[model samples]
Every structure is written in structure tokens, then in C-alpha cells.
Target chain A: MNKFTEDDLKKELETKEYEYGFYTDIEADKFPIGLNEDVVIAISRKKNEPEWMTEWRLEAFKVWKEMKEPEWANVRYEKPKFQEISYYSAPIQKPKLDSLDQVDPELLKTFEKLGISIDEQKRLSNVAVDIVIDSVSVATTFKKTLNEKGIIFCPISEAIQEHPELVRKHLGTIVPTTDNFYAALNSAVFSDGSFCYIPKGVTCPMELSTYFRINEGGTGQFERTLVIADEGSFVSYLEGCTAPARDENQLHAAVVELIALDNAEIKYSTVQNWFPGDKEGKGGVFNFVTKRGLCEKNAKISWTQVETGSAVTWKYPSCVLKGDNSVGEFYSIAVTNNFQQADTGTKMIHLGKNTKSTIISKGVSAGKSQNSYRGLVQIGPRAHNARNFSQCDSLLMGDQCGAHTFPYIEVKNKSAQIEHEATTSKIGEDQLFYCNQRGIDTEKAIALIVNGFSKEVLNKLPMEFAVEAQKLLEISLEGSVG
Target chain B: MLQVKNLHASINDKEILKGINLEIKAGEVHAIMGPNGSGKSTLSAVIAGKEEYEVTEGSVLLNNEDLEDFAPEERAHKGIFLSFQYPIEIPGVTVTNFIKTAINSTRKAKGLEDLPAKEMLKLIREKADLLEIDRKFLSRSLNEGFSGGEKKRNEIFQMAMLEPKLAILDETDSGLDIDALKVVANGVNKLKSKDNAVLVITHYQRLLDYIVPDFVHVLHNGKIVKSGGKELALELEEKGYDWLK
Candidate 1:
């Protein structure tokens, strides 16, 4: 309203620095740079993993050695040198604290800067958090409250020691060690991630969350997460990540597997805001992840993600419906600005009768970045009366950016019903003028328009997450247009 | 309250409003009638500070202040409003929210706090009643899937809310039936006062019958060729625009 000219908006955008760009000076116990049999064994040994787990990682390492990096995504970047990445890195002194006051001050300050203060979150949102810093879980809050409900919530390493049966039963069942290139690599060297289990017929009273931070400079975060919802149970899990700005691209390859048995439901949400380097595309995180879930009879699985960071992102959180009357849903909003590139979407596989799936994806591309939504929906031969609906919309800020959609639908059953709709549009000058005439400046106008364009997916997020995601979208597109 | 002197404007090097001159005082309703390509909308756009048009030579002033350097929004904050002929459809933003943003933004420009929600809702309800608008219509996305008549009514509804010192209705009666035209004209009439003015640009004289402009001017080839009292509109209505050619 104070006459914010296009130049002013552009300048404001250029000055928008990454909020989570600070680095902590904690000493790291990191493995040597490079990926080999020795590195994998070292990571497994450092975790003090069991013999069977060690053997499983060795098998994954062998498969990863022979696999090739996927080149099918609609993105262009220099291939990451896997051999140059530190396979594992963690804080030298791990904190086994029972309360927030006992945690390290520096780590707590980092969380405060990221707006995930343990005390604040616990008092306000009632969300239990598992804080992971540099491939290790530092402190998990509200563990007692969760334990009272027969819920097992802790780091993966702790789970392996305390609840080995649950860890081993569903670790690689949905996403096996040989699923893909990144999954294989992550399976071989995953240092630490969150593990959640909900007992039979018990609904988790609070939202469970994991905050992942990559503090070390040259380390690659290979984290694996497993969530299991027993029969007639329900759980909602969310994860968030951020890293410091680096000159050399960092690697983040993660694997997450979810299992929901009969009459169970699981909702998984992610808000990823890793450092996306500088304006010239100098350095950022290269996030390549594989997340998938399995649904049994009358079970439901929903994946909602707001991806706004990473220099280059390649992920497809998918669902496999193997039981009758199962349902799968995906709602995503992927934003790319400056030199960032994102190729993220979902895959829904219908293998049983009366299966249903819905996919709503919104891609926003600004500056010179590229954003693509590549998804697949398949109905098998025995999937009688299956249904699938997909809507993909792209909003472009300037002429230099690009938004593309690739939807693959295959139906072997003649009774299946599938519908797909896609539209590509730019923020029109007329729209801007309309807002301008109404006394709204260009900056606020862009934010309003972009939020409106992404309302469908943003509405799918939780209340607090929706607010954060909206701010993230505004930040990502700042200075993207003049 | 508004003045346009020797207004020469063009877009993409093609001259549109060539040497147009106009003036409107407070408590007056003036209508500008023009044939196709006569630059009626161009005159309104140039006066509203649209950036696409290059002002070759001339000046537009509001309350004796030159408006050349003001952006469209700045002009709005300074009490100038243009009711667009085709309002943009912003999906997922309710009409109520859009208007709230506009009002709050203007208030912010004036260094004032946002209007209280209770007062804002009361004003909205009062204006909706004046325009005979349904309460449900205010909650729908702005102009998305709206009928043409509904869009015009919404524009006037906004004018009622903003209460600008100078309002330019560009082709407000183009796509409305007689009843819709009467409703819009009545709403505009209700908002008129001794301290503000209205400049109506239209191709038809039907709207003038309801609002009854004090003066009617014929714009031809980017110039006002004739000016007269309200009787001029009747004459133009009797004879087509070809008579002027």
C-alpha cells in the first residue's frame, strides 16, 4: 500500500536470506569420505547394529555398487560424487537427556532458531518431537506421555535395541533394500531416523514429529524411518529438515517405510526447507529420497508434503494398496525459486478390488528454476471397480522458470475408472493490475495469488503446518519477479 | 474534483486518446459516450494510471495534484477508483476476503489501523443491502463463475465500500439487462454525494435514464467532438454513432 514498486519487490526478494543458515561448532564423529564396503561396515559398527542387520546392509551395499543413478527425471545438474561424501557424521557426545534442561545449550539454540523449540512445542502444540542432529537422535520429548498409550516412539537405533521385534518386522517390508538406487544406498548407510509404533486399537493422542538437521559440512544424511500402525489403530507423523548453506553440494538420501494393517490409518506429512544455496546456484543440498507405504484391508494412507528447499530434489512418496477396499491419497505443494530444481510427486498402485486413490499436486516455479510433477497410477488386473483421480496444476512467476507435468496411468482392469486433469498458467499482468488498482502492492498480490493457487493442497496440511508452509511459499518466491 | 487537460496517450506507439479534455466538479455526474475505437476506455485507463499507455503530452490532476507519478494503487489510495468492465477472476479468494484486503491495505497506506471486524461486517452488510446482493454471494470466490450482472453489481459494491472521491464507471452497463442496469445505477446513485463526483463511460444511453448524468459528451476518434446537457444522450440514442462520422 505504500507504493511498493517492482524494483523494491525485487530488491526485497534478493535480500531474502535463508533463515536456517547458521552452523553449530560441535565436534563430529564422522566416517572418512567415500562409499565402500568398509564405509558401510563402519557405519553399521558405529551404530552397534545386530549381525542380521549388518548382513542386510552388506547385501544392499552390493546392489548399490552395481546400480546406476537415475537420469529419467526432468532436471539438469551435475551428478553428485557419492565417493566424496562422508557416509556418517554425528555429534561427538550424544545426549541421553530426560528433559529439555539437560540437553546441550547449542543444540537447543539451533532448534529455537528453527522455530521448533522443545519447550515451546511441548507447551503449545502438544506434538511429541524426536530431534535428530547429524545422524543421531539427540532428545525425544513427551516420551512418557506417548509410552502411557502403549506407543513406541524413539530413534531408530534406540528402537533396534528396545523394540527389536517391531523394528525387524516392518523395517524393509514396504520399501525393501533393493527398491531403487537411492533406497539401496540409504539402506546400506542410514545412520539414524525416527521409529514410531502404535499398538492395536489405540489412537495416538498427540501428533508425533521428527526434526532432522544436517550440521556437518561434507556429510551425507542417510536416515531411515519406519512407522507401523497395528490393526484398528491410527497415527499421524510429520518430519521437517534444514541445513546450513554450503559451497559444495551436500547429499541427503533417505528411505521411509510405513505399514498399516487391517482397519488402520496412517498420515505422514513433511515440510522440507533445506538450504538451497545462493542466488547463483553455488551450493545447496541434493535431496534424493524414497518413501513408500503398504495398506492392508480397509486401511488408509495419506502423504502430504510441502517441499520448498533443496537445490535439487527427486522424491516420490508412494502407496501400494494390496488389500480390498484400501485407500491412498497424496497432496503436495512443491515450490522452486532461483536455481533450485524439484521433481517430486507420488505413485499409487492398486492391486486389490475396490481400491481408490487421489492425487492433487501444485507446482510453483519462479526465477530460473524448474519444477515438475511426475506421478504414476496403476490398477492391476484383479483390481475390480478401482478408481483414481489426479489433478496437477502449475503456476509460473516469470518467463525464465518452467513447470512440467508427466502423468502415467495404466489400468489392466476394464472396470477401473481413472481421471486426470492438468493445467498450465502464468500469473497474468492483468491479475497484478487488478490487485494494484485495489491498493494491494505487487508483493502482497503475488503471495495472495500463489496461496490461492495452492489452496487445495495447503488446506490438506495441519493448522500450524499450513501457516508455516504459506510463509515458506512466500519466502521462496521473493525477488523471483520484478 | 477531477480534471484532464490535453490528454494525449498511446499504447505500443499507436495513439489512442488524442488531445482529450474533460472536467468534473463535486456533486456532478458526467457521461462520456463514444463509438467503437473512440478511446473511451483508454481515457479511463490513462486517468487511472495504467502503465501500459505512454502519456505523450498532457496532464491528469485530482484535487489540483498531478497524478503522473502515482501508481494505480497509489491513485486509489488518493481517492480515485475505476470500475473495471471485466473484473479478474481470482479463484479461491472469497469476495469478502478480497475486499477486506483492499480496505485494510488502503487504511495502512493512510497510516491507520485495520477497521474492526464488527464495523467492517456491518458496512459490508449495509452495502450488500443497498445493492440487493445475497449474503451467500459474498463468500464465493471473486468473480469466478459469476454472471455478468453479478460482476457489475460486485464492482459497485466495492465502490460503495471504498467511497472514493472520484469514481470512473467504464462500460458499466455493457452486459446488463434493464433490471440489472437499474440495480447498478441505483447503487451508484445511492453512493453519490455533494463531496464526490461520477464519470460514466458507456456506449448506450439506457443507464443514463436511471442515473441521469448532468452532462453528456460524444467522444470520436480520441477527441470530444460534441458536448451538451442530458438531452444529448437522447439525440445520440435516436441516431447511431454514424451520424457523428
Candidate 2:
């Protein structure tokens, strides 16, 4: 204590304070905190889902009841009390109007903050948006254009209603309902998420994005996102998430499954900016998500993510190479600052002969935050000639922060080839001095270095989301570096 | 425009520069020649405000202001530039973006307005031509996959862009052919003006043939042992640093 100065105490206090800690005010319907069979039935019935869908939900609930929470992720937190969370929270019913003004004002305001409101763009050019507020889809834009191209882009609820066969065929095929704890929960209680289906031999004309905003407190968001690209089809989807600043930690358990058939390609990206808890680690989001993709013969699937928010993050967007000559790629940049802890990466399972996968991950930690990259590449016994390359790099700014990399590679086939490289180093004073001598201040210099570090992953993101991600990265590392 | 009075600097508890005194007026080109263990680079690094080097004693004045209190970036805004001996390779960041950001940042620090994209593009193109740097190099990441000569040229291009009041070339001629050295020298000469100063730090005087210096000083054992006119560099080139030792 004698050696500790006032500056040290102030620094400790500053590390605990959360920058984005302002809550959004709204009133709406919310279910009692907790999960049970009745709650599952209530969620399905409230959405007016078909009887078979309701039965499916019940079956998943039954399976979920028999399973235990997964303990494999390198994240530890107070397990969210599932029974104390409200899975259903929506605005008052309104007419299904065709224009933006017909939507609820609260939902509109949320989208406004997200920078993707329909009112912001009179004629949406290449961007199509689906707004998911709380546990339900509020609205989707550019419906006519997607319909013209014979591409189905809508909410999963709507997909269940209009394209039930497509949903039934592909849903849970890649990631089963009981694959993991969060996935199992999402399987039984997911409220709403975006769904896209590209017809065979057709290339989607524009990028599709889903913006998710968690508005209600003490409510867990279980979003189920599914994408299906048929033979010779191509589609790119962007998913972004945010929650109003609050003191009560919220739970977000999402399940996303992507399937690319022969000669089809799919690119899925996420810019996760969930509200991490304030200093003292109070009131943030515990984000546990299961995102996986399946590439059929000659198919390609790529996943890119920029994860910055969340008090604790546990996710690994993965791929299953099932078809011969299929390709899988993952590029990710995860930044954690100020009492934030994130353990994220991807898994690539090569099952078809001659399949390949590549992964590049960059992690940055500052301000008492802990960031890690946990990835796995598995080559199946039958997958001869399988190939994989992985690179994981970590950048540390201050002594208080920690950066880690853990990669697991398993090769069963004698002909398979796998290579992995990882390095962890601090942003040396020399590097900072170099930038500073160029007239960039300490803060701006750190941002430049970080952006340069994540450029590969950021470049894979959609233009709109990439810009937002860049801004988020800058804000997250504000006064922590240099 | 630069003054160091009995400046003492050290790294890791070991003193590298001891009781060094130097002065440079505007429009003067000063060359510091030294052997491997000499502190020529240490002087440039300390003046550039590298954090690794601690100024244990004495003071540095740039145009009559206390230089110790300024940050590295503030010193840069005061028109000080160091052409790194080995340019860092920043992957994935284009040279255009890096230089533009650096230029605009300096401008902003000086309370100047931001440069428009079109204006910056035009300016960069003009400077690239002046330095004989290929336009494609501007689009690539800074020093990424560049050859030895290309890296040196890139450093010169950056020096041309910054147009600093004091330019410190730390061994800028160490890894260049005769032709490349001439091109770099030409670039430096074009950037020279009556209001700015240039400090050439190198062990070899080969670079002096291209950009003749106004003064040459011999640094040995962390101190300047000899000083003379331009002919001094030619003399050192002929006799080698062994004579100074």
C-alpha cells in the first residue's frame, strides 16, 4: 500500500467503469423469468406457430430437460438462471403495414441507433435489413427485391409459415438441437431470427443483414438463424448485435446453422457489440453462441467476425467439410478491453476427401481484459488428402491485460496435412514510438495498429458493418493503449 | 535549429551517450560518422523521444524550447522526422493509407484542416514521381515484401511527404546501391530548404558523394572526437574511422 500511488488507484477505478452504460427505456410484455415446458408452449403459441412446430418445440424441450450444461468453453461465469429469464417480450400488436412508418416507434428508434433504419435510406440499394428486437423479429426491408430474385429472406417465423418444408429439411441438420447447452436452450425457446434461402443456380443480388437489439432486461435472447445456399448459389449475410446499457447481466444464447450445397458458397459475418458489464463487472451480457456451417461437395463457407463487447464471450463459429473438394475458411478479430473477457475462435472438421480449411485469428487485450483464441481443426479418418492451415496472433497493450492462444489439431488420415502457427507479443514501445513520430497521438496510433492487425478480418465484413466494427474497435481501446 | 547541451542518455541502466553536445542551424547538413559501438544512432533516437532511451541528464532545445517535455508525436508536429534505419513492415495497411493518416495526423496536431481524399491522392502522386517511387508501391502495404533498396526508397518517399524541419537519416545509405543512393539523395536534396536542417548518421561516407554535407563529425565512445568541413567526410572516407579511433 505504501508503494501504491493515487494514480494507481485512479487507474484501477477507471478500468472498472464501463463506457457504454446507458439503458434504453421502454415498456412492453415480458414473460416470467424462467424456463419450463409451459414457457416453451407459450412462446410457440404466442407466435401462432403451426401445431407441428409447437410439437417440435416440445420435443426439443423434452430433450433439453435431459441434458446438462456444457463445460468445455474456456469461460467461467455464473450460469444464467434459465428459469428466471423471460423468453417472450414483444411490443403491442400492430397492423401489418407495408411502409416503415407503420412499424412501432420503439422498434424504429432502436434501428435508428443501429444505423440501419429504413427511414435513413429512401431507396435501399444493395442492403436488405431484418430488425430483430428482443426475442422477436420486428420487420424486414427490401422484401420485393429479394422476391424478384427468387431468394427467400425473411424471419425464421415467417419461413416456418411459408417455407415449412425447407425449414424442416435443413433445420438442426448441421447443429443438432442437443449439440450443446446453449444450442439446446435455443432449440427449445428461440423466439425469432433471420432466415435466408438462395435458389439453385442463382446468385443473390445483394448483401443481407440482420440487426439484433436486446431491449428488455432480465430476458434471455435465444435467436435461431439458418441459411441455405443451394447448388450453384451464393449469398453473404451479416449479423450485428447490441443491447442497451444496463446493470443486470443479460443472457444471449444463439444458434446459427449454415448449409452450402454443391458448388454453392456462403459467407457469414458477425459484428458483436453486446453491452459488456460496467466496471466492477456488474450488468453486462453473457454471450454464449453456437454457430456452424456445412459445406457440401465443391461448396465453400467462410465465417468472419469482429467481437468487441460482452462481459464474457463463449463462441466458436465452425464448419463441417462434408463434400469432396469442399472449402472452409474462418477469419476473426476479437478485442477485449476494461474488465471484458472473451474466448472465441472457430472449429473446422474435415470429413470429405480432398477438403480444405484455413483460419486466421487475431486477439487484442487491454485494460485488465483477457482475450484468447481457442480453435480446433480435425481431419477425419476417411478424409484422405485433407489440408488445413491456421494462424493465431495476440497483441497485448498493457501489463494488466492478458492475451492467449490455444489451438488443437487432430489428423487421422495418413495423407492429411495440417499446419498451425501462433504468436503472442505486446505492442512494443518501439512500434508506438514509430507511429507517434509520424504525428499520430498515442490513442490514434494504437487504433491504427489494431485496425492494421484486424484488417484481414475486417475486409471480409460487409461494407456497412465493417465501418461500424472499425468504430467499435476504436472506441473499445480508447485510452488503454500507448 | 537543434541544440543538445551535455545530453546524457541511457538504455537498461547502461549509458550510451555521455556528455554529448551538438548544434545545427537551419539549412545545414550535419553528418555523424562512427564505428559499431559509437552512439550515433542513440543521439537520433533520444532526440526523436523513443521511450526506451532515458534522458538521464542535460537538456535538448529545438528552436529554443525545452524538448524533454514533448511527446514523440509533439516533437513530430514540431517538424522532426526519423527515417528509420529499418522501416517496419505493417502488413495489410496500404502505404497510401499509412502516409495519408500520418500526414493528416501531423496536420491536425498543428491545428490544420484535414486533407481531402482527392487532394491527398494528387499530392501523393506528385511526391511519388519526385522520388522515383513506383505508383504501385504507394498502394501496397508499407515495406511489406519490399526489397532492401525498395525499403530505403520508401523511407525517402515518407521523408518527402513529411517535409520536416529536421530530418534524421539513420544509416539511410547502409543498404543501397549507387543508383539507389543517388535517387534517395536527390529526394533528400529536393526536400531541403533554407528553414530546415538534415542530420545524416552513417558509418560510411559513400552517401556524402551524392548529398554533400556542410559539416562532418566523428563520434567515438559516446562522444564527438572530431569535427570539420565537407572535406572531412572525403578525408574520413579515404582514411576510414580507424584514424579517429
Candidate 3:
């Protein structure tokens, strides 16, 4: 750095592009463009779903047709053309493989490039991975170990056939199909995702993870994930996502439901890194997700997410505390850069006596992006002594970028105690100079500062994913400073 | 080993430090004193390569190499350290983590491997003990909610860790009780060596009583109008800048 090398000799890029920009050209089984009742029925029928499941899809499709895309979020973008997007696109299927070696080499390479090698993950870590590419879950590792303890973990499509009673009982119960436009859409046409059922008194021994990749262009990925933890059981789930670079914006609508039964606990985390498009913002992913968890008496559910991508993001991972003494927690760090827009936060509904919830959200905006934290905390009637603490912090990297907060609190019970704190700040030039004077480069200094700003939330992630989340924060803000 | 030759600088096209010429060899301590707005801080910032001040004329050399093209961080890698008058707050970065990063970054810039964690721990323990900093204080967020004295003490702690060839302390004694100032000055004194020099910029002579400068230069307006032995600071302390003017 002291040598003052010429531009040609400077090895680093002046500005970084999305690292996961390469597209995989594997042959896929793509349906023709458009969505209708037939497409919903076809998606269910193609999975060889039961008659009741197909009926369920038809009902959701009817609900979706009547619902409209809500525009209450703080963002501006053109409406997506529903008729131009293919509802389902899956990698070309080979016969059931006994091991990952038999899986398509191209599919394996796609995961490899994303740094999630299925074979390595199986051997090295105690993390059970469900690899979902495009619209299908290709592999589920550590199934036998989980099955030995009466736990059921597999693809939702397979769950409908093999564990029909469990699927039938829990599906659409937490997140009803008529929840919203995107939820109804996801329910009607979700091709494939992961499903887990933890038996009573059984704690999952390994971290259950799902890696999602959208490789096929012009196709919408609607995935549904459901986790049911029985009484006194515990489970931790992690989700990660990425998409190939494309000029035409793609749509991603996913629904995740968690049912933590009495005395059970569930920790859910997501690292979302969909393409945020080129600097001029011509194309990227529109990530609209409905994620909520239901907690029974004495149950607990915690949702943590690090979102650094998606040109437009509208997500709120919420918790409904229907049982007394239940606990809810939402810790998030959302970073938006280069024309990206995000309106993401969490909701905590306290309906039971002594229910407690905590919300810590951090938003970092760089370039021309807009980031907002919109959250709600509701204390229902008869919920005596319900307590909630929420902190919303926003950090702006440049003058052009923006950070906003919208917090809604409703308390019907007089005994409810809710404390909320919010602050907006810009990265000070003195702070950067102080770091530079210490020999840390500006890029690394920004990362350090951001990590420090987001430490409270990052600490909630699993150790392995925490490292990746920190790196993603750095990459998302690279070249944002001069 | 440090040379600032006829330096002229400005901020927002307004001139500060119209002309400053100073030099310090190894094993020397230099103090620049003046009243308010005398450009003592501007000189320190210019030496540290802060972007705000545009150096209009003259050159600063460290070990015979001109430092015009080097960035603030590059200048840091070339052994220039500036302790700010007001330290910035990083809410969640602990002092231990910040110092480790600073040391490792300097090492990395020199094409050296990161110091092993064990070595880093030992160094941190030694420096913290020398500075009379409690172990628990190292774990708190850097400068967040810290008292003024704690902030200045932490700056000296960082200087001890970096061990720069030339350390510039800008108004290091602005807010300090006798006990805390002694701890800070003791820390700085313990780190001074034959291979490095110190530049202390202060408006008051209270700190110089402890730091004991070898040379004192009186600054008026943006220029250093008088230079003399360490007695110059004592004389100005009694007579004030009005006498010099």
C-alpha cells in the first residue's frame, strides 16, 4: 500500500461485484410461463401429492386469486408480471440416488461454488443439510441419525406421502394459507422445501440447515418450510439462500411456519443473499417472505436473520405467544447496498400472561439503497405482566443511502411493559480516520465498525454461520467508501 | 528521524499552519504550545494524513522518504501514529479486539503473518499492566460511554501496542485529573525509546511537567513564531502568548 502502485498493478477491484454472480447451465424441467388454478394443481400433482394435499393447494389458489399484493412497505418498484413467470422449475431428475456421488455433477458444482459441499458437510460437521436447488430438495443428510430418535426430517413433498398424518396436522395451521397474498401464493405453488418433526422430549443432536439456490432464470421459487417441535423438544434450524445474476428480476416468495409446543424451544436463523443486481439496478431478486412461529405454554421461539441481498425485501419473522410464560426473540441485521430496498423487521404478539419478547434490529444502508426496520409489538387483553423490549438502530454509510424505522406498539393490558429505543447515525469521517491512522485500511475498518455495530445480533447466530455473516457484511459494503 | 519542512496546510480553502518547520531526532521529545486556534492540532492531523487538511506546500519526510502519496493508513504502516483529541466511539468493539486488529493490520501491511493469539495475549497483558488498565476495562466497548480520562488512557494504550516510530499526541491532557494524567503520562513515558520520538501538542503546560519535553516551540496564528529549549514552555506558561505576540 505504501508503494503507490499503478492502476494495472493494483490487484484489488476498485469496486466489488456480487461474488455469487455465476449462473449454472444445467438442464431443468421448467413449466411454461404463467400461474393459474391448473398450475397449482399441476405442481401438487407433479409431486405425487395426496388428494387432500391437492385440495389444499386448490383452496390456497382460490384465496390467492382474491387477495391483492399489499403495498404498505416503504419501497418503490414496478409490479411483477405474474403471467410472465414460470411457477416451477427443478433440476432434471435422475433416479433416486443412494449417495451424493450419483447426484448430477453440475448440481454438485453449483453447491460447491456456493461453498456448501454436501459431501463435505456430511463428513465434517454435525450440521444436517437439506440442499434445495431451484425447486427441489436434492439431498437430506443425517436422516438416519434423526430418524433413530423418532424424528422425521425430509422434503415437504416427501413428507406429504410418508408422514401424511404429521404434515396434515401441522401444514397451514401456524401460517394459514389465507394469511396474505404472498403466503397464499407460496401455499398454492410451493414446489419443494424442508420439513422437520421433533418427537416429544427429543432434542435434535445436529443443527438442521437448508441451502437454497435459484439457478433457473425466469422462474419463481415458492418454498414452504414447516418445523414442529413436540412437547419438551428443542431444535435449531438455519437457512441460507443465493441466486445467479440475471438481468430480469426474479420473484422469491417463501412461507416458513414453526410450532414450538409446550415446554419446547426453537431457534431459527437465515442468511439471505439473493443477487442485489448490478450497480445501476437493472435486475435482481424480489424476496417476499412470510415467516412466523407459534409458541405454546412455556415454549420459546427465537428468530435471527442477516439479510444482505435482494433488490427488494419484505419480510417479518414474527412470534405468536399463545401460551403463558412463553418467550419470543427476534435479532436481525439487514444491510442494503446499491439500489437495494428492504423493509424488514419482526412482530411479537403476547397473548398469554407473563409472556416476554425482545427485539434487536440493526439496519445498514450504503450506496443508493434504502433500508427500513418496521416492527410491531402487541400485548393482548388479559396478558398480565407481559413485557417487551425493542431496539431499532440504523447506520448509513453515505449521504445518498437512507435508513428508516417504523415501530408500532399496541397494548390492551394496563400491566404490560414495553420499552423501545431507536437511533439513526452515519459512519463518521473521524471514525474512519481514527481507524486509518491505526493502519487498518478503510475497507477493513468499515467491516470492523459494522461488525461492532451488529455484534449483538451476530452473536446470536451459530458460530459457523456467524463467520459467514460477518464476511457477507464486509462484502456487501465493499467499495462503498472512497 | 522525523522532518516537517515549511509545511503549509488549509481546510476548506481557509489557511491553517501557514508555515511549520520542525525536526526531532531519535530519543527526543518535542512540545508545540500555543493558545486556542494556534493550529497545533492541524499540524498533528497533517502529519497523520487526515484527508480534511490540504497540505498546500512543503514536505514531511520519515527516514528520508517523502510521505506525499501515502494514505493515512499507509502513513501508519510507515510508522506515523496520531492520538486524537477526541476519540471516536465504536459501540461494540472491545478495546482488546480493536488493539488486536490494529496490530495485526500493521503486521499484515508489512507482509508479516498475524501475531499468534498467545503472543497477542501476552503483549496485551503486558501493555495493560504497564498502563495500569484493569483487565475488565479491556473487554468494554471501545470509547463507548467511557469517561474522558479513560479515553485518553486508552489512546496511550494503543500507542504502546502500535510502537510507532513517531507518536503525535494532540492535546492529550485536555481532560484529566492528576491521578489519571499521571497514569497516562507514565504509560507514554514507559513506551518512549531511543529508536522513536514523541510530539506533544498542548495549550497548557500542566502535561509538560510530567512529559518533560526536550524542545518547546511556541506557535502563534498558523506559524511557529518562536523556538527554544524546554524553558520556553515554562516562560509561556507564566507570560502567556500575549507576551510573544
Best by lDDT: 3
Local error of candidate 3 at A28, Å?
Answer: 0.5
Each prediction's total of clashing residue pairs, residues at least 3 apart in sequence or on different chains, is 1, 8, 0
Give model 2's TM-score versus the native structure: 0.92
Where is the poorest 10-residue window by lDDT in model 2 chain A? A1-10
Candidate 2: which stretches are off by over 4 Å?
A: A1-21, A93-95, A121-125, B12-15, B237-245
Q: Write the per-residue lDDT of candidate 1 for residues A1-482, one digit (tens) a residue.
A: 21222223334455478877889888788788888898888888888888888888999999988999999999888998888988888887645777777777888888888888888898888999998999999888898999899999999998988888888878888888888899999999999999999999999998899989899999999899999999999999988888888788998999999999999999999999998878998899999999999999999999999999999999999999998999999999999999999999999999989999999999999999999999999999999999999999999988999999999999899999999999888999888888888888787788878888888888887777777777777777777778
DockQ values per model: 0.52, 0.40, 0.59
- The estimated TM-scores of all candidates read 0.96, 0.92, 0.97
User: Candidate 3 lDDT, tens digit per residue, A1-482?
Assistant: 11111121122224377878898878989999998989988888889999999999999999999999999999999989998999999888774666887788888888888888887787776789988899788887888899899888888888898999999999999889999999999999999998999999999998999999789989999999999999999999999998988999999999999999999999999999999988898899999999999999999999999999899999999999999999999999999998999999999999999999999999999999999999999999978999999999999998999999999999999999999999998899989999999998888788889999999999999887887787778778887886
After superposing candidate 1 on the true structure, give the runs of residues whose Cα lies further than 4 Å from its correct spot. Answer: A1-15, B116-118
Which residue pairs collide in model 3, if any?
none
Q: Could you give me the TM-score of model 3 versus the true structure?
A: 0.97
**Model 2's lDDT to the true fold?**
0.85
